[model samples]
Target: MGCDGGTIPKRHELVKGPKKVEQVDKNAALIARWNYCAISQRPLRKPIVACELGRLYNKDVVIEYLLDTSPEKCIIETAAHIKNLKDVKELNLTDNPAWKGDKVNTKGDKYEDLQGAAFICPVVGLEMNGRQKFCYLRDCGCVFSERAMKEIKTEVCHKCGKPFKEDDVIILNGNKEEIADLQRKMEERKLKAKLLKKAKKSKAIESCVKSARTEANALSSSSSSTSTTGGKAEKPGKPVSGIAK
Candidate 1:
């Protein structure tokens, strides 16, 4: 029976039960992570970079965040806790064959086959759509899959001929174990850079001291020469005075 202005209640409506929470769609989450900036959540544009923690971001947005002094405007506040721009590597992304650029279709549909992955590993062809692990070289900015890296096991980049150190490889969108390993690598790289900077500053200070000492010694020698010449000139003047015939 209906009560007031309400419709009839179902038999199950009278029974009390636990509330069911809506589950998040994994596909949507993956799509978002692959295409959007971790900090600003805007669609990633050219000059894309990855953090040591394996998060994707746009380079220009990162620069703006760094330049902005106000905390309110700072989107990548956690980025400050990061060492510097050196901590992030710019990605060398690959273009997908089946899709057009942002002018046509930036986002893909759920029903249709996903097209235009923002990035892919050059070595193993693993798309950077959050399916597999990927890493980029800090030295050459080349992207490659973790599997390819493990299989190849070389210090140099596969795509580029440039030499790279073990510290130059930084993972992007890595899982828990991979992320932990990446964090360790990041700390080690920063430590090495810090030590190098200190060594350079010490060397500069030593060089300055040496230069100053050399200049002072030259000045002292000049003063002594002038003093001896003056003494000789005084003797000559005296010879022309009372001692002169």
Candidate 2:
């Protein structure tokens, strides 16, 4: 109902109360913390915070969406750093029997999934202008949003054959480039290790040469002392204190 001021009374105002301030939820706070660590290069804290936060269902959803979206045999982060428990936890999100393939109307589907779904990817709860907009990663097999696809020059994803725009799409070929770079780095490291090993061996050989020279000097000194004693031994039978000459 309108007040005498001609403005409609809020639901709480009619009830003689003030609206409560919305606070960030605990799960979201945990996820935010994890993301902060990832961006900050402090993944060492990930396990501790993950243990404390237990599990985030939404995080699982995002992971699954990433896996389904990527053309490669998708694993989280880097392949060599895979931890079994972590991966299992991530992959199990799709196993939620409660989903039943229903339309993800959490807020609303923004993009049209012409290939398969309107929104197959899970939503990341990011807020803007007092409203939450979920972010999703598109699959390589699918076309970008009709409007987004119109603006780009790329015809298709090189890895998965999905059509895309130059801007809306992330190319999977960059990952291959990264892999190649890593391989080159590894080769360089191996070469460095081999050189260090050779240097160590050379140092040991040099030490051995010095020790051999010292041993030869000691042997020569011992032989000279023996000769001096032999020269002085001639008078031993004649007198105990007599000189050898």
Candidate 3:
């Protein structure tokens, strides 16, 4: 029977257990990330990567999409200035068996269900949905949880066999402090590259100028010598010109 006053109050009105702030945040982030691939407009999958601009994409998707460029292979950029696979380090991402993220949830999926999924770290199995720290090696591009890198402390890349140093590691979407450091490094590198290119162009110009000057000098010398020889071979102005002074 209904209460004499009115209907009963709902649990949400009375109970104050916890909030869904974290879940809502995660849901929004994943929706933004997984909506589409930047280059191909395809669904994101394993071995995803981010460019220097920090746009996420599937490695395979980029490869196929780049085929359209043909002879002029795609010139992609990342933190390490990638041009191709050689320039990019294949990410060794972990598989989240708990949540495959394959089944399309027409309706909004709960945040807890997508936890540690979509993109997980190979070493620590942590989700890359902005909850924790993660980094990719500039030399190899192998991504790993910040915790794993800190705890492991190895010189070699965990995904690839290539050797790397502490400086080769770049954090993905790091905090303000980390972003400041990365920004400084990127700016310094770009400045150095610009200077080096200018130096090369200047050297090329100088070489061309010197070559042209040398050719002009040789031609001038030859012309003068030819004229002098012709004048000397005039046979002392000949007998016909004897009347001349």
Candidate 4:
């Protein structure tokens, strides 16, 4: 249709260009990864746990998933790697004093800080809000910022003072390469456990077989000694009878 009255029609109005691609917001993605459980998509709460791949989850949700006989496909896919409680470590997160968590804003006009984190690193005091890299010790489950770890090089956990090796340090919400490395470590740990179990089983079987052989030998020797004693006694008795006759 022609423009109303003396109005001119712009070329943009007549010709529509290609639609702009809708991109995901970086802040929203960070919030999703740091604040919410990877499996249930619920807000992370106390007694939070993380898997081998460094995905954070609520302990209760993971327990429910493990107990479920027929879990939803999404849940199964998200937590398929978690076989038992041992697969996840309960995070020891330090509470951020500045963070007012889900508190009802008495002043309705006050702006909410979505970037505020619930936890922080005890050492460097960096918020664990996905802005900075964080890691937890597998030996102690104490969380600390990556910066703190690098600055203070020690074998013990900064928060709990528990000794840990280089392999025990697992990065939280790590990148694809870090996740792959963690996966390899996980497989190696499982393999070592299996080999240890097998060795124990074989040792037990060997012990049982040795004990059985010892018992059998003892029985045979006892029976042979009794037969020999009986033969000697019978021979002596026969000789005495012949002499008396």
TM-score on alpha carbons, each prediction? 0.73, 0.27, 0.56, 0.84
Per-residue accuracy of model 3 over 28-52 as CA lDDT, tens digit each: 6554554445566566666677654
The best candidate by TM-score is 4
Extract clashing residue pairs from model 1: none
For candidate 1, write residues 4-85 as lDDT tens digits. 7788887788897889989999788777777888778888888998887778889987876667777576445536545457
Off by over 4 Å in 1: 1-26, 74-78, 82-84, 99-116, 232-245
Q: Which residue window of length 10 is worst by lDDT in model 3?
A: 74-83
Candidate 4, residues 1-245, lDDT tens digits: the string is 56778687889988999999999998898889999998899999999999878899999999988888764535556688898999999999999999976776667655545689999999989999999999999877899999999999998888778889999999999988999999999999999999999999999999999999999999999999999988884334435554555
- Candidate 2 yields a Cα-based lDDT of 0.38
**Which runs of model 4 end up more than 4 angstroms from their true locations?**
1-21, 71-75, 107-112, 233-245
Candidate 4 residue 7 Cα shift, in angstroms, is 12
- Clash number for each model: 0, 1, 1, 0
Question: Per-residue error at 4 for model 4, in Å?
Answer: 13
Tens-digit per-residue lDDT, 129-191, candidate 2? 112211112332231222333343356643355555433232211235644653464456557
List lDDT for all candidates, in order.
Answer: 0.76, 0.38, 0.67, 0.89
